[model samples]
Target: MADSIAELIFIPAPGVGHIISTIEIAKLLVTRDHQLSITVLVINPPPTFGSGSAITTYIQSLANTTMDRISFIELPQDKTRQDSKAPMAAFTDFINSHCKHVRKIVADKMSQPDSGRVAGFVVDMFCTGMIDVANEFNVPTFVFFTSNAAFLGFKLYIQTLSDNKNQDVVELSNSDSTISVPSFVKPVPTKVFPTICQSQEGLEFVLGSARKLREAKAIIVNTFLELETHAIDSLSKESTIPMVYPVGPILNLEAGAGKASSDDDIIAWLDTQPPSSVVFLCFGSMGSFDEDQVKEIANGLERSGHRFLWSLRRPPSDQTSRAPSDYEDPETVLPEGFLERTAGIGKVTGWVPQVAVLAHVAVGGFVSHCGWNSLLESLWFGVPSAAWPIYAEQQINAFEMVVELGLAVEIKLDYKKDFFNPKADKVTAEEIESGVRRLMEDNKVRTEVKEMREKSRAAVLEGGSSYASVGRLILDVKRNIL
Candidate 1:
């Protein structure tokens, strides 16, 4: 049986967040079916980013352990400078250029005897261009959407509407007008729409990908049915979209390998604090604030008077750079005497073992950028949050967490129009203090998160919604081979 196994090829977009989640999904697939093999085609990061090496190291470590069932092939470095002024345009162009390379790899793998039959292709949502390549090979293709279902529902709805018209219908004005999406009961504020929907180019890029998504055999989201039942139900009603699978909360279970720093000191600090007394603030890999914002955050922590463990990083030179930084002196960026005043009550570091810190008994609350991965981690650990979204789809995630899911306290719902622009109303120290206090002191929010936490764990266990979804996906792939 093993000798005649089928292989699945995965192509992930070029980012730490996308790459890590895609790798975890592949691991889950291989674990579920022993007769399955996976080959991940990794795209090279642009030369400017430094954290690409970390992703490479993480993938290599996984390959070393699962040598027989898993392997990787990195796309050649793209030396041609990305000419698109917008980030989405640049990423879309990059993925479009790799269809030929992926087609060749799929062809070569199918021809080799020991390589097994090429059963299908699993691509990251950003790499939907590869759907064309999969169609050429006459193999089933699945899209792994790394975010929640509400966002996916919104995308599918917008795509359906856009297909009917030749021009962009979404108004990009700065008003507080609301738009009704099919998934949510409440109308979404136009300002809270994804950054990609704010501009003509970004909208076109998203619409193009959404169109390609319709061609996939299935769409897999990194969320559970219990978490986003409304959104999942809404997407399921769409006849044009492919089958949807809620097979996740697929997290990086391993520690120490790809972490930016050792968590020994952070853990030691948490050990000294009382149970559920400290708040942990960590933005995602790309999350950082300007010096002004940092000073306000420092003041807010002091005013909140709660024990805190803040994983701080110097803001990047440019907004587009998502690279994690080397350790630096906090005094240079923080206000004078800020560290001295918060010494006993807080510990600030460049990076910490996020999972370990969140799992600590002392962690009562979280101040997060509301990246989907960070949000899931906080929920998985039963920690309530002060949602402070930074970039990408974070604002939408924050909105869903606070408004739709009832999981978190809102700090700023729509902070910015896009990454290139600053927030219209800067978040002040007073708002931060209020938000932190609400997350830490509110008993109802704490209890709700704890309940959600249990649900999250059960969803991934045997016979649970996420667990069954994974099984169904495996069976679906095997059925295709027959």
Candidate 2:
């Protein structure tokens, strides 16, 4: 059976982050099981979503693989997204559009005798709609969850929020009651609920996806069990949900595309700084702020009086929503003389490689938007973080970090848009300074992060938990094939 071959079809959503992690998961599976092969199906993203140069470069780099086990199929751009819909709708619609293409592709693979058994389908977090196509072929399906266990549990348990089915989620979010979910150890404050889920469309989309996940054989999460023991355990005991696999901290370390750092200047600057000296402030690829917020950040960093590496990006100019672009001149939004005063202690640049910067010996503290991948990278590199969630499920991840796990220091300030005060800075200089200071100076957080760092590396090793989890997943897929 070990010598018998089988193939897994991967369908990742068009976002760069989703594609990158899907590739990592594919790579990890094939590496662990000699009998396995992978075929990745990529959806062509809309033009307004950015050039997708990052995904292009990443796929190109993998051209040198030793064995020709992994393959890619770029699906045609048949899905014309409704720009006015929420992001969740766009993703679901785009992926749902590709169902016929995927069905045809899988049918072709199944017909080819040389391609091996069609073992299973691995769909992205938002791509669960593909499960029906897999069902049509009588193949099992697995959902690759890109976030932490906490976020997964939140999504799965979120069906209870249907009482607000007719109400706007934003109004529901404003309610005074705390949230008690089966998966979380503590009651989550309404303030930290994901901003997107506060909308009617977004809530419906999230709940819809969560319900669909129960149809899969299991969910492959990008986190180690040791890091999220309570959430993982809570999710595993759920009889209704499918099997839960914790096979992660799966990261793409290539420079530029994902959390990789490749800038020569950023590396050189870090090389000169002393070990455990610099504080890194990088929100995820999409994180950026208005001029008021940018100024507040500068003030806060300056007040911290620590050596800093800040990835400062400007919000898109066209007012069409997209990832933040690097400022041609960062000094434009910065206060007068702010750059001059902090020149000796700080280096500001556009989009520093996150994992690359986090791995630096000089980086000690991280003030982040608490994206799941970024949080995992921070743990893998042993740097403590202060959570400043901007949007998406980050607020939930932040709550789990600050309240449930104590793995990160909390940055008190909502990153949500204030319609009443559009230009107002959400966080004060003092609050930012406080979070960074605690992250850097607090021994407890540093100690716990360092221990988790050891556990994270060990989890991927030969006999570690993640390694075992992958082994179990391989066995399950093979059994499904037979």
Best by TM-score: 1
* Residue 351's lDDT in candidate 2: 71
**In candidate 1, what are the lDDT values of residues 142-203, reduced to their tens digit?**
99999999988877777766777543555642456877888786787777777667667778
TM-score of each: 0.94, 0.92
Candidate 2 C-alpha lDDT tens digits along 1-482:
55678889998877667877888888888888788999888776554655544444444444344445898877766635487865667667767988999989999998987778988999988889999999999999999999988888887767645643443455757675577877788987777777666666767787788889889999999999888888999988888879999998898876463443438778888999999999999988777888887888889889888889989988766634465778889999998899899988899899777767888899999998888988888999999889998777888888888778888998863565421223534698888888888888999989988999999999999999999999999999999666
Q: Model 1: clashing residue pairs?
A: none
TM-score of 2: 0.92
Off by over 4 Å in 2: 51-67, 79-81, 84-87, 161-171, 257-262, 319-321, 417-425
Give candidate 1 regions above 4 Å deviation.
1-3, 50-68, 165-173, 255-261, 318-321, 324-327, 417-419, 422-425
Candidate 1: how many backbone clashes?
A: 0
